[model samples]
Target: MSDAVQASGAPAPVGHYPHARRVGQLLFLSGIGPRDPASNAIVGNVHDADGHLISYDIDAQCRAVFANVRAVLQASGARWEDLVDVTVYLTDMARDFKAYNRVWAECFPDASRAPCRTTLGINALPTPIAIELKCVAEIKSPLPLAGEG
Candidate 1:
């Protein structure tokens, strides 16, 4: 196997870029958005920041991002608890930070023992998306089944 597998459960593969890649024990996931992996519909956030079809709910967005993260981990045969690091990018840091933290706390409690994280404020993001999250994880090798021998 290419020492890894590409995770593709999102609404759509926005571009040619692969959703995730695995090299030996390490798995790297791309930025995640709040949308239905199948329909590509933005989740939660009902009203757009400037009032448009493209919108995002803070909690929903967080969940969607994590959902995508979870999918990638599973595709690589990994798990959320296996995550070692994460990076987040936001359009408006001041406006969304508080809400983001609320959701973050729920998603990653005791992050100190979870994984290293860094959030940054950006000018904008992909169409209809406000926040994106990426992460790194270590996939554990699977042992033989209980009675495979």
Candidate 2:
């Protein structure tokens, strides 16, 4: 049976779903954004007087989103090196791609160790965040249930 993972250290999911799900050796993470866990605030977002998004810092968002992904991976008993694939979504590809790529290289410094990635330019997200990541990891060990050690 598959198990759902809810990371207490990560922001609560925007919808009813858990942060991730594990089926066999694979852990699939939901779309992870740059929302802070304690405040639920969008990182790097610059809003206008009426709270509309004016701009964002893609580098900060990328770091935060990667941190969120790491939290989900840890909660699922996986590791950063276990990530097999990642799908990135950006609201403004033309403006953010270079900064995003720079942060990505920092996170995955070694080309041989980096996960397979696909980045897409999207119109919007559930929130005003500029970027999000969907990730898949190969778990080397079985994840314990909520009650068991």
Candidate 3:
């Protein structure tokens, strides 16, 4: 049954797809954008890249994106505290970079102990949402090592 979902507390996948997957003691999560998992769409279109679409608000997107990430962690039995490393991708650095770090600090427990992170700007992404986060986490479990006899 555990192989089925022992880690889950009968939690559903964030979508038809999983927000995260656990192999051994590691969890790999997809980017959590600013959207309610139930809704599957960002509250509104985010026009982040060079004013491509219409909206260009960074704060709102950061909040929502982080929230989505939380949901994923919960579903996978991991948490921000469990995170070992994170990768963030964005489109515009000048306009949103400073604000992004500020939001991240507010969203997490402490920056000093925060997971190793990388932030970079790209020309394009799946949506206009200003920030996307992917995480890797470790959950301690008792299992025999391959070399164990």
Candidate 4:
């Protein structure tokens, strides 16, 4: 059976779905954006009081997205090292990929430790942010509080 994961410390999902789901040893995360958990605000974009888009910084968005993903993974009892695959969505690959890659490198550091990833250029996303990330991770057993035999 699969169990849904909703991280209380993360932003509430924009939709009805949980942030992640765990099935056996695998955990699947939903598309994670740069929304601040406390404010529900997009991290890298500036908007007017009327909610009109102004400008954005891709690097800042990338870092926030990664941080949000990390929070989801941890809530599911997984870590960055446990990630097996990741899918990245970008509204403007031509403009944002380089900076995003740099932040990604900082997170993984060792090339060998980095998870397999695919990045796609898209027309748009649910939010005004430039990037989002979703991933799958292998969950290690013997969880600290899962249960005791």
lDDT, candidate 4, 1-149, per-residue tens: 68899987788889989999999999999999999999998887888899899899899888888889888888888887999999999999998999999999989899898999999999999878899888999998634456732
Tell me how far the alpha carbon of residue 122 in candidate 3 is from the true structure, in angstroms, after superposition.
0.4
- Winner of 1 and 4 under lDDT: 4
Among the numbered candidates, top lDDT falls to 2
Model 2's alpha-carbon lDDT is 0.92
Leading candidate by TM-score? 2
In model 2, state the lDDT of residue 34.
100
Ranking by lDDT: 2, 4, 1, 3
lDDT over C-alpha atoms for residue 61 of model 3: 76
lDDT of 1: 0.76
What TM-score does candidate 3 reach? 0.74
Candidate 3 per-residue lDDT over residues 1-149, each given as its tens digit: 12122223222344466556678788787666676555556655655579556765678778877776666666565666888898988878888899898988886767788889999888767655667778788766443344651
Which 10-residue window of candidate 1 scores lowest in summed lDDT? 140-149
Off by over 4 Å in 4: 143-149
Candidate 3, residue 124: the lDDT equals 69
Pairs in steric clash, model 1:
10-37, 11-37, 11-38, 45-56, 45-57
RMSD of 2: 1.2
Cα RMSD of predicted structure 3: 7.1
Residue range with the least summed lDDT across 10 consecutive positions in model 2: 140-149
- Candidate 1: where is the Cα deviation over 4 Å? 1-4, 45-51, 142-149
Q: Each model's RMSD to truth, in Å?
A: 4.1, 1.2, 7.1, 2.1
